[model samples]
Target: MNDTQSVNATSSNDTMLVTKQVHEIEQFETFGGDIIKNVRVGWESYGELNDDKSNVILITHYFTGTSHAAGKYHPDDEEPGYWDSIIGPNKAIDTNRFFVISVDSLVNINAYDENVITTGPASINPDTGKPYGLSFPVVTMRDFVNVQKSVLASLGINKLYAVAGPSMGSMQAIEWASAYPDMVPRLISVIGTVKADGWTTATLEQWTTPIRLDKNWRGGAYYDQPPENFPNEGLAAALALVTQSALAPNFFNDVNAQLLAQADGKPDLYDIQQSPVIVQWLMERARGRTTSMDANHLLYLVRANQLFLTGMNDDIEQGLANIKAKTLFIPATQDQLLMPYHLERARDMLKANDKEVELVYLEGDLGHLEGLSGIAIHSETIRAFLAD
Candidate 1:
């Protein structure tokens, strides 16, 4: 498929459900020294920009999320964007009061999904006339913010009212404040931390292991061959592992136990009594992702996530000090992947630096997914923070 082909080919709607646009950057050089001749970033916007452009809020998306932030792609869409509940006219984000915008991160995994447009490993390299594959430059949160800076500039927005996001999105928010503290007045980071700790780095390594081990992976160059050459099974397994980590262990276990109880006295297979059944369910969910996701794209996202650190340098203290935006850190109480303690450390650093910062813990059972799924519970708090 060509770069212009939408990843979401299954969407039957002749018209787009959301207003998707692209910003193309010619001869963009990445932080890692690789050069992409042409870069396309998919983006969507909600509400309108005020004449002064002061009522704009940049909403960065988390890993696996798309630029579609609040609207249904079509009337038949099963659901809207990830944060639909929190962003809309008079909603928590209050689109009536602010212009909300979201952009696909560089090499966003969603690009692998049909109907989504992004320049990633799968995009045709102008230099090679083929897929970039493993040749795609490694990008950082700073690179994400830089591309977004271009997007904002293209829209004639010189300053932002606030920058907010969850998970990987939050990382970009932090980067924005550090990279351009004067441009952002406020920041809301949910279920994220300033740096990728040893635990997070190790977990990410495990997530990519399966894909790397897959014989079909071909060192991220599988695109040169046929569809059968793709690492579907490995990608599915990796996604399953991600799903397992995306939730609270206790919540998952409790639900599993309840399901097992309800299956009591049933036939051996029908009972679903074994732990393997839960594993099977997780893998099944992963299998569904394999249809819309590419292993190489996922690997790129994982690598970007692994390298996340707040400051320009490796100095966390200096990075925290440079941030002038009033910041709110919302960590999920039950999030095992991005545990509250990680945010606690960040809070301490921000406080020690005397930056305007607030720490809030999201009390929910969904764990890391709570950032998106449990937004309702924290909507009022977010609204108030933005208002203040």
Candidate 2:
């Protein structure tokens, strides 16, 4: 089992499980013309609220990820931590010095947990008493950041030590830094871009297409009576795209070989979990995303990601002027989703703006997966930046 799996088995020993509380914030008239009412926010903190409450570091999670960043669900379990490598006492993001707060994204695929307060197509609308399905308002990266700010405000945290994340989470981190420059002073953006490019947008659209085109989608209302196609096929197709985009080249080949070795030439069922065989399962997990998050939210977030021209001054002589924090732009050289060239561009932009920026090209074949995999490689750099 992976270290995370082993830790999952005995999580309660090293972590605390606060009551998963849901707070109803405000209703938002989304960009897509759908009204999102009583948006619920769920959150947890992994350290004490200091006397000053200034030791807060917001850790945003990636796509297809849950709010369980680490530790045991209960107090009696033996597992270590989820980000045990980068978080905790004396680790990169030492829990001893910093209070780390990780939150779930709105309408994210992993938004079903009790600890995750979210609003999307799958949520039951107070007005209709039915899942919004496709009727939910579309959201954007900026909207998500605004919600997070609301959560922070509710908790009385007016400023942050840093905001960090990988992939989609990274996109939010950048937006948070740019949108609320005075709030976040340190930022770690990994394996992502300020804006999603045409290629990336096409990729996201295709990922959703597999599910949308399935007759089972029933015009996005397949909750009670899904069709035979069930969009599971679409989900699977999307996962294939996800896998290809997230992992580095040849990772599957290596995994396949390892699984075969473990089987010792016998019928090997190892890694079936990560294999294409489980596409249906993965598809089901991604089903019925918030309908209110219409094409507009997608397009908005995509544009937000694609339009990120951080260092470009309207005039070259003006230099880089917008950035306010020290940024660490770490992208995998083999990244398939957000290419390495984007990081190079970011570095130039930050440099132009006279901001302290560092670009560390993660050297790994894990491709986009290097964001997670390469964390260990540059954990020290991150630690030092946090310390600074």
Candidate 3:
């Protein structure tokens, strides 16, 4: 075997600090009819699987998140996992009582980060001995859930007590309940929808425009070039747009107001559109993200999110009816991406079909990101739901 095969040979059970492990699935066929000769799924487990393998909770990750859902990779690390507030020993998910697992999505943009292992545009194609680039197959939420099922099977887990996630992770959670209803008994979908509406699809497409228009993009085949030659500008611009959509308008305005107030003596720009402070902040944030993300991987994730549907088909009613899990829809009131109306629509359909479902509105100023920032405020509510 060559270098690629050697990487694939690493065991998923191997543990390194607080980072995730890798499980290689050989010769996989994607939902889009593309064949992936080898797929590396990065996953991390907290707590212990019970003897009967029943007390399991799968914590799917949001966009840009890795499988490191809890604990610190290094003692000096500045932050813990994204959902660390809810996944510890006595927290909402309660690792002491239930085993928790998180997996990095197939084309996760953060695959370049040492903590994650994933097969994406950057990975070497065993057959061609070159980066897959745009040749990496487009995947849907169902495909992500299917891979997670393999992870569970590898661990001897036949059923999950609950599957919970926020944003893109919530999409995977919804897919899991719909695609494998028998496997998941409970699902917590926070800031997510059952289907990607036309508006959502169009918005996602717009996010990719900057990347596609970038000269260095070269149809996703620029990986062999120098770092500076990659589509950093386009990726940064796309991320800036993403940040704008992720926060509530009021929250951004308030932040700008505070910044303006802080510079009391300075001349008021008066024009929010051309505010130097806001533009600088957005650019800096996007630039920081581009430092760790792979452009092609980000594009793949966007496409996957765009094509998400509950049933993996266009029949929304039937898809809602197919979910057997006791579902909870937590929509952030200020979220512009996955709006409250989307969850309301799903709740209405599930109720009409006599499926067990509940809708919970998360009132917050953080918008889509509230799914992470507001967890502490709703910890009790989530804990109660999980217990039930």
Cα lDDT tens digits, model 2, 1-388, are: 0001111122133454543334456676543455678777565566555778798888776766545565555676465334556866667887777777776567756433444566666678899898777676656666667777776776778999999888877877877887678898999998877665567777766656655665666776765653343445555555556666677657756765665566534433576644442333334443444321232223233333443433222232232354588999888888888898876777787787678998887888788877875677888989988887
Could you tell me every candidate's TM-score relative to the true structure?
0.92, 0.80, 0.92
lDDT for position 327 in model 2: 92
> lDDT by residue for model 1 over 1-388, one digit each (tens)?
0122222211134322465777888877777777777788887777778889899899988888877777776677787888888888778888778888888888887656665767889899887799988888888888888888888887778999999999999999998998899999999999998989899999988989999999999888888787766898899889988888889988788877776677644345655664455666677788888877778888889888888888758888888888999989999999988888877898888888878888888887899999889877888888999996
lDDT of 2: 0.64
> What TM value does model 1 have?
0.92
Tell me the number of clashing residue pairs for each predicted model: 6, 27, 0
Candidate closer to the true structure by lDDT (higher is better), 1 or 2: 1
- Cα lDDT listed for each candidate: 0.82, 0.64, 0.83
Question: Worst 10-residue stretch by lDDT in candidate 3?
Answer: 1-10
**How does residue 183 of candidate 2 score in lDDT?**
90
